[model samples]
Target: MATITKRSEDYSKWYQELVIKAGLAEPSEVRGCMIIKPYGFAIWEKIQAYLDRRFKETGHQNAYFPIFIPKSFFSKEAEHVEGFAKEAAVVTHYRLKNSPDGKGVIVDPEAKLEEEYIVRPTSETIIWNTYRNWIQSYRDLPILINQWANVVRWEMRTRLFLRTSEFLWQEGHTAHETADEALAEARQMLEVYREFAENLLAVPVIAGSKSPSERFAGAIETFTIEGLMQDGKALQMGTSHFLGQNFAKAFDVKFLNRDGKQEYVWATSWGVSTRLIGALIMTHSDDNGLVLPPKIAPLQVVIVPIYKKTEQLEQITEYVQPIIKGLRAKGITVKFDNDNNKTPGWKFNEYELKGVPVRIAVGPRDMKGRSVEIARRDTLEKKTYPVDNVAEIVDNLLVQIQNDIFQRALDYRQKHTYYVDSWEEFKQRIEEGGFVLAHWDGTDETEARIKELTKATIRVLPVEEIKEQGKDLLTGKLSERRVVFARAY
Candidate 1:
C-alpha cells in the first residue's frame, strides 16, 4: 500500500507514482527503458487489437521487417540521416572475446562484419530498400504493409511509456503509384488515429499537418494528432508522413506503368507509439488515479462484496453471480473482488487507482433492498440502483461515461486555444503554453527562429487553410491564413 501523492500538489511526481503503484510499468535498469507490467500490456493489447482490425479493413497487410539495417541505407537519404544520426544506436561489433589480461571480454576484431548495422529509429530506409525488390509492375503499385515491433532511439532523457529508449509501436509503410494516392493514404491514417484517440482513449486531439521545419526527417509532408495534457503541455499523440518519391528514388523502387514507362513509387509511413498511453493518462486521470475510458479498459466493471460477517459475504456473492453472468454475456469485462483480507473501502480505492470505469458495491443492506451502489470513476459520483435492471443501467452508464470524458477534453481544448494576429500577442500567449493560432511567412528559417526563441514550433498546418488577412507574427510580413503553433512534446 504505497501512499500516492495528490496530483494538485505535484503533477509530474503524481504521474510517476500512479504508473508504478497501479501495476502499469516501471523503470528498468537500462538507463532509458521501462518494463510494462501485465496490466499495462493488457491496455496496449486492446489498442493493438482495435488498430489491427482497422488497418486490415483499410486494405493493409501485416509484415515483419529486419530490426537491424545496414548503416549505408540511412545515408542514402541525406536529410533523414542528418536528423536521426545523433540519436542512432549503432552496432559496431558482432562478437566478443576474452582479453589477454583475462579481466573481461573485449570486442572481437576477427568477428567484425563487412558493414555496421544501425538499430532502426524508424523503418523507412529498410522498408524502402525492400520495396525496391518487391515492386516491379503497375499491379504491385499499392503495397500497404504494417509492422508491429519495438524501435530504439537513444534519448538523453526518458520517461516511462513517453520517451523511452526502446518502446513498442506499429509502423505502416505503404507504396503507391501516384503522389496523390500516397498523400490520401497519409491523411486517411491520420484520421484513423484521431478517431482512435478520441473515441477509444477518450482523449481529444486536433488533426492537421506539420510545418516544413517540424515535418518528419525525409517526409515531404507530415500530419499529426496533438492532445493537451492536464498540466497545460501539448503531446503529439501520433504522426503520418507522406514521402512523395524521395524514398523510391533513393532505393530505385521503380515499376513499369500501364504505358510501359518506368516510374518511381510514392511512399508513406505513419505510426502511433506507446506515448499514447502517456497522453491518455495525463488527460483524463485525476488526483485519485487513472480513469480509463470504458472502451479500452481491461476491466469495465468491478463488483466488490461488502459484508460484516462470513454469512453475509456468501449472500452478497450469491446475489452478484447472476448479474455478473448477464454483464459478461453482453461483452462486458467484469471482475468480482472477493479477497477476504482487504476491506471493501480498500478495494474501492484500489480499483479506482486502476481506473476501472464502473464499480458496484453489493452489501447485506443493499441486498435486503434489492439494490446496489454503483460508482462512476470519471466523476466519483455514486447512485443506488435496483438489481432488477442493473445490467441495462450499467451498459447505459458505461456509454455515458465514455462520451462525457471526450466532451470534457473537447471543451478544455476549445477554451485553451488562442488566435493571435501579432507577434507580441503570440509571444505573450505562448508563454502560458496552449495552442496559438498565428500566420507564418511559410519559410523554414522563420519557423526555426520561432522555435529557438519561444520553444514553440508549428504543430500543424490545416489541410484547408483559413482565409484571413494577417501578418507573419515573427517576420512582420503579410500572410493569408494562420497555422497552429504550440510548444510541443
Candidate 2:
C-alpha cells in the first residue's frame, strides 16, 4: 500500500503521490510525456462521452484533421503565429540515415521538404485553410466540426493531465454566415462547457469573456470557464473564441450570398483539454486521497466483502453477489472485492486512494445484523443501512454526494472570492491567492503592468456583468465593469 501524507502539510507532494498510487498516470521515458494508466484513461473516456454528447446536441459534427500543418499555414495569421511561435515543435527533416563513419543515425538532409511543417498546437490555421476550399455559398456556411486529437505545445513545464507537452483534446472549428451567428455559437458552447463542468464534474466555474490581453491569439473575443482549485489557484478549464472574419479573411473563406455578392464567413473555435481532469482532482480530492464525483467515478461504488478466514469468504461472497447485481441494475458501476489475501483494512485504503465515491463494507458483524456499512469518500462519514435497501440507498447517496461536492466547492468559492475596489486591496488579496474581482481600464498595457507586478491576470470578465458599468481600480478612471483576476494554472 502507498504511504501517502496529508495534503495540508505538503500539497504538491500529496498530489503527486495520489496520482501515482491511484494508478492514474505516470511519467514516460520521453521528457514531458505521460503514460495515462487504465484508471486515468477511464476518467478521460467518461469526459469524452459527456462532451461528445453535448457537442452533438449543439449541432456539431465530428471529423478528423491532419496532425501536421505546413509551417506557412501558421504564419498566415500574424498574431496567432507570434503567440504560438515560441512553443511550436517544427519538423525540418523527415528521414534519418546512418552516417558514412557509422557513428550514429543523422538527419537525412537530402530528404528535407521545400517547406517545413509544424505539429499543431491548435488547429485554427489548418482548419480555416481547409474551409476556404470547402465553402462556395452562404448555404454552405456554418461549418461546425470538432476533432478529437493529440496536440503538442512543447510546454517548458509539465504536469500530468494539466500542462503537458502533448495532451489529448477536442478542438471545435465553426464557420458562420454572419458575425452574430458565430458569436452565438461561441456563447452556446461556453454554456455547454459550464453545464458539463458544474453538473458532471461537480466543479463550479465562473463563465465569462476574456480580457483583450488574455483573449485567444487571433480571436475577437474569448469566453472561458475558470475554476478555483482547493489550493487557491485558479484553473482556466475551457475556452470558446469568436473569430470575427479574422480567420475567414486570412484564409479567403468567402461564400456568395443570395444577393450574388461574396462575403467573408465569420468563425469560432473552442476547446477543453485533459486539463479538466486536473481541475476535478484539485477541486474535491482531500489529504486522504482523491474524492471523485459519483457521475465520473469509474467505479461508483466498490463493495468489500470483509471476512476473517477462508471459511467466512463463501458467506461474504454470497451476500455481496446480490448487492452487486442490484447496484448494476440501478445503473451504478460496482466492483466486488472478495480477495482473501488482502486484509479488509488494506482494501479500504486501496479503494480510498483510488477515489471510489462510495465504499460498502459487508463484514461478519454487519452481515449478522442484516445491514452493511456505507462510507462516503468526501465526508469520510460511515453509516449503517439495511441490506434490503442497498440498491436504492446507494443510488440516492451517490446523487447526494455529487450535489454535496459541487455545493461545497461553490460555498468555498463564495467565501474566498473577494471584490476589491482599490488597487492596494487587489494586490494584497492576489498574493493571498483566490479570485479577486476588480475593474479595469480595458487597456492591454494596464493588464500587462499588473501581471508584471503580480503574476495574476484577468481570469474572465463576466459577460453579463461587463454589460453594466463600473469604475477602474487603478486609475479611478470610468470603466465598463469588473473581471476576475487570479494566479492561474
Candidate 3:
C-alpha cells in the first residue's frame, strides 16, 4: 500500500520511503535513533561476516570494551577530547526516583557519582587506557583487536542511517611497536574496506588518504574510501586512521623496545557503520525499489508458483520442488512462495520492491514446455530458460549481476568525475555536483576559503597521485597535483 517517490522528484523523500516501505529500518522512539528491521539487519550481518573473517585471517582478534568511560579519560588526549566534547552524552547520576507528582521518575540528586561517565563516541580513549595495563614489553608490542558495538554521538540532525545518534558498527583498535607497521595496518584495512564495498556491495569507491583538514582528530593520517551516489554526492564509505602514538602517549602506554628502551606504542583505529546502508541505498537503489547486489542480498532467488486453481497450484509446486532442492544444495538463499492469500502478480511486485536479484516464475504453460521465466531486478529484463540445470544458471547469473552492477557504478563515477583547471570551472562543477578534481595551494587557509565560497571539501588525496605541475584554483599558488573535492553526505 506504500507508494515510492521517484528519485528524480525527491531523493531524500524517496530514500526514507524505500527504507520504511521495503521493511529495512525505521526511526525509533528515542530521538535520533533507528530500529534496523530484520531485513536490514540481515544485510548488516552479511557485512560483519565478511569483514570479521577477513580481520581474523589478517591476524586480528575480537575483543570487547566497556561502553562507558570516565569523563577524565577523555581529557588525556587534548585534540581527541576537543573533537568529541560537543557530542559526548554524559551520565551524571546513577539512580532515579519517583517524581513528586507521581508521573515519571527523576534523577536522584543524592545518588550522584563522584565523576561523570561519557557514553562512547569512539573507544580510543578507553581502549588505550586498558592497553596500558595489558602491555609491558616488546613481546606485547603488536595488539590487533576489533569490537562489534554501538556508539552514541548525540547528533543534532539525524537521518535513518546516515547521521543517526546511535548506530551499530565494528571498531578496530590496534597497536604496533613501530610507526611503519601501524601505517601498514591502516592502509591494509582501508584496502579491505575498498574490496568489500566494490565487490560485495557493487559500489565503486575511490580509496585514498584524507587531507590534514579532513583527517580524523588526533590521527597523523586518515585513509578512506569514498563512494559516489546516484545524486552525484560523495559518501564516505569507510576510514582507517594512523594514530602515531597520540593515544599511546596520552594513556602512558609504553612497552620495552627490542633494545631495552621504553617507547610509546604506535596505534591505529578504523571503522565503518550503519551509514554504509545509506550509501548502499543511494548508490544503487532505483525509483521502483531497492536494488541490492546478489552477493549480499538476503533473498537471492525467489520461486513464485502461478496457477488458476488448487490442483494446478499443486502441480506447479511439485514441479518446482526439484529446482528448489537444487538451488538450496548449491547454497543459494531462495524461497518458494506458494501462498494462496497473495496472487502471483502480487508476489512478483513484492519481491521486486524487496530487491530480489532473480525471480523464477513457474506456470502451466512453462511447466508443460519444461521451461521457466526468470526476471532480473537490475535490468528489469526477463528470459526463458529450459528447466535443465536451472540452479547452475541462476548461480552464474547472480555472479554476472554482481559484476555488472559494480561496472555500471564504476562507469557512472568516471562519467560524472570532472577535471577543472580554472576557478570558474571548479565553481560551476561543484554546484552541479560530482567529484571535481583541482589543485590546491596546500594551505589550511586556502582550503577554508574555498569551502567558504563553495560547500565542497577535499574528499581525498589519491594515494597514487600523478605529479602534474599546476596552480591553485583560487589563489594561483604553486601546487604539485590535484585533489578530489566534493560535497559529501
**Alpha carbon lDDT of each predicted model:** 0.91, 0.91, 0.93
Clashing pairs in 3: none
Give a tens-digit lDDT track for model 2, residues 159-231: 8888889999999999998889999999999999999999999999999998888889999999999999987
lDDT string for model 3 (147-191, tens) is 999999999899998999999999999999999999999999999
Q: Quote the positional error of residue 364 for candidate 1 in Å.
A: 0.8
Q: Which tens-of-lDDT digit does each residue in 329-355 have in candidate 1?
A: 889999999999999889999999999
TM-score (C-alpha) between model 3 and the true structure: 0.99
The runs of at least 3 residues in candidate 2 whose Cα sits more than 4 Å from the true structure, single-residue gaps closed, are: 99-104, 466-470
Per-model TM values vs. the true structure: 0.97, 0.97, 0.99
- Top candidate, metric lDDT: 3
- For model 2, give the 10-residue run with minimal summed lDDT: 466-475
Clashes of each: 0, 0, 0
